[model samples]
Target: MSTRLDELVQELGQADRQERIELLIDLARELPPLPDRLAGSRDESHRVPECQSPVFLFVEPAESGRIRLYADAPAEAPTVRGFVALLVAGLDGATPAEVANLPDDILDRSGVREILGMQRISGLYGILRRLRALAAQLPQPESPAKMPADTPSADPPSAASSDPSTAAASTPDPEALIAALRTVTDPELHVNVIDLGLVYGIQTQGHEVHVEMTLTSPACPAGPQMIRDAVAALEKVEGVTKAHVKLVMNPPWSPDRMTDAARDELGIF
Candidate 1:
């Protein structure tokens, strides 16, 4: 039998883009408020730092030996709120192992990526990460009776851990981060920021990446979105836990900075 989350992912995968958005909005409306006990405790400590929206999560063991996940996100951020609600509905009653064993790419698998901006997607990833980390801290199930029907007793190791090459690639590297950023494009130009000479520098420390880049112009309207996209792209890399993007304008962007490919595409002589 498929879990509620598995069915939900299938539904999202089957829906058209517009219908998916509507479904997400409806799910957002379904997120219940934090219970009175946890209501007063939704402070900075419980907040998910990656989300731009004010989102908080709490996990507690249920009387039935399952775990309950409670989340709170403002009504204004429907996308994030919807994802939180979806998780709660799907996994709230699941055993710790089930929640901990969730696939890391559940967001992409659901096909919701099409409707979400890169920044929002990154934030949602953070929420999942936070949830899983909290789940890992819970006590493990001692017997088969504790496992839910949705979760199988025998489980395979995650690909990242099972594959030698994949395990090695999980650490953030300059090349990987750069390659990831190459996917972000300037909305107006349809040219990747990398080829457009928008990215100035990239630094990596452990799982974090720090970037310094400039825009076409100081007043470029797409600056903010571009920055967010760049950050999202970097963080999406297997090992990157955080991405910091800095905007620098001291050296103004000029056509001279564009890569040959970008110039050729733009028909610049």
Candidate 2:
């Protein structure tokens, strides 16, 4: 581990859940403003698609073989912004080899994983993955024997139906759709949103499917990603040609919305 990362882990290790959250907010506030060149640019290439927040990042080799990271996350998404800030503080100024050798479970050692949730932690992993990829582009010493386990696979498992007979079916199976939706998880909570009671309703007309859902918070950084995942999950269902997700905040979300299983996992007795 980098010295900075080790220090951070030790600092955060002493805090309780709520204190960890406060520290994250403080880190978010301390995040440096983006450089003018990359700020507000619409270059899709820099965007981290895995993040639900509109986060964009880039890494470049700096003087003395150091690496510099630049990132932008919306102010509304403090959790995401804080995470970005954490990465910047931890890995900035580190050598390429140090970055490339970062352990996949680095975040797990931070002592804030439970408070940050699985989704946010997962997005943090995505940021690290991008950083490593950028670092790999520059000339370096012999690569590590093993890559980080959390690095996303190039070939995602196919969700398409294997049976050709079911491929053209026009009716979307409600059960199958539900099952597919179940596959989409809340990265932070490590629980399916369905079990969290995020899905308010699901409907299908012809081959188009519509889903109504809400997030744990209106300002959830993972909101957009969750919505996209929901749509993608639905589209993978047999007979669903299109998928639409409507995010609702009228009723809001509360612990009561969670299913017994979710509550059990979260120890919400």
Candidate 3:
């Protein structure tokens, strides 16, 4: 393990829930300011679209084999900022090979998974994957493209198909759509959104499907990523060609909406 990562794991391991959050915020504050060229709207190419927050990341390779990481996240999204802060600080000055070999489950060891939830953990993985991809430019072994096991595919099936038979065969089933959605978990609550009653409705028209869902809170930072993941999950079904998600605030979510199984898992009376 890298020294910095080891130290981070130790620090996180010792902190309680609230203290861990405070430590993350402190790390966010410590993230060095990005150079003007890489800040603001200038670095669109470096943006991590997989992140719920509008996070931009860039990797700079040094002659000495070490690489420098630059990242920017909104202050409103402190959790993401902190996550990027952790990566920037921990991986700074590490060689491209070192980063490429970094453990896939490093975040799990950091104890952040218990606090930040799976969505944020998955976003962290997205950052690492992008970082490694950038670093691979430095003459690394060729590896087949692979999506993170915990993340949904970023590329959905193309809506435009040349064959009508193919398009018709790709029509999604409502039952299958709901089943695929059951695989998505609420980041904060750690419960499947279906069981939590976050899914308001599902509709399918030929090869296109639409879903209506709500977040536990109107201000949930993970909302965008969740929607993206939902779309991706739907698109992965054998017959889905297009997936559309609509966020609904009306008929707002409540604990009362959760299934008895969810309540049991959460220890709610």
* Regions of candidate 2 where Cα sits further than 4 Å from its true position: 40-42, 141-269
For candidate 2, write residues 1-269 as lDDT tens digits.
57997687667667787787788789889988888886867465676656677788777778877888777888898877877787788888887777766666656666657777766676666666656655545555443322223323343322343344544465688778888888989888988987887875565545656676788888889988998899899889878777777787734455544645322322100
Candidate maximizing TM-score: 1
What is each predicted model's overall lDDT from 0 to 1?
A: 0.73, 0.69, 0.70
Model 2 alpha-carbon miss at residue 166, Å = 60
TM-score of 3: 0.50
Write model 1 residue lDDT over 143-243, tens digit each, in one string: 32221232222333345544567546566766787788889999999998888877755655455566777898899999999988998998799787777
Global lDDT of model 2? 0.69
Per residue, candidate 3 scores C-alpha lDDT tens digits across 1-269 of 46896788678768888998898899889989888876765354576656777788777877666787788888887767887888788888777767756665667766778888865576776666666555544543333222222233345535444356666666666668878888888888888778887885666655666677789889999999889889899989877777777887744455545745323322100
Q: CA lDDT of 248 in candidate 1?
A: 75
- The true-structure Cα RMSD of candidate 1 reads 16.9
TM-score of predicted structure 2? 0.50
Q: Which scores greater on lDDT, model 1 or model 2?
A: 1
Better of 2 and 3 by TM-score: 2
After superposing candidate 1 on the true structure, give the runs of residues whose Cα lies further than 4 Å from its correct spot: 143-269
lDDT of the structure predicted as candidate 3: 0.70
Q: Which ten residues in a row are the worst by lDDT in model 2?
A: 260-269
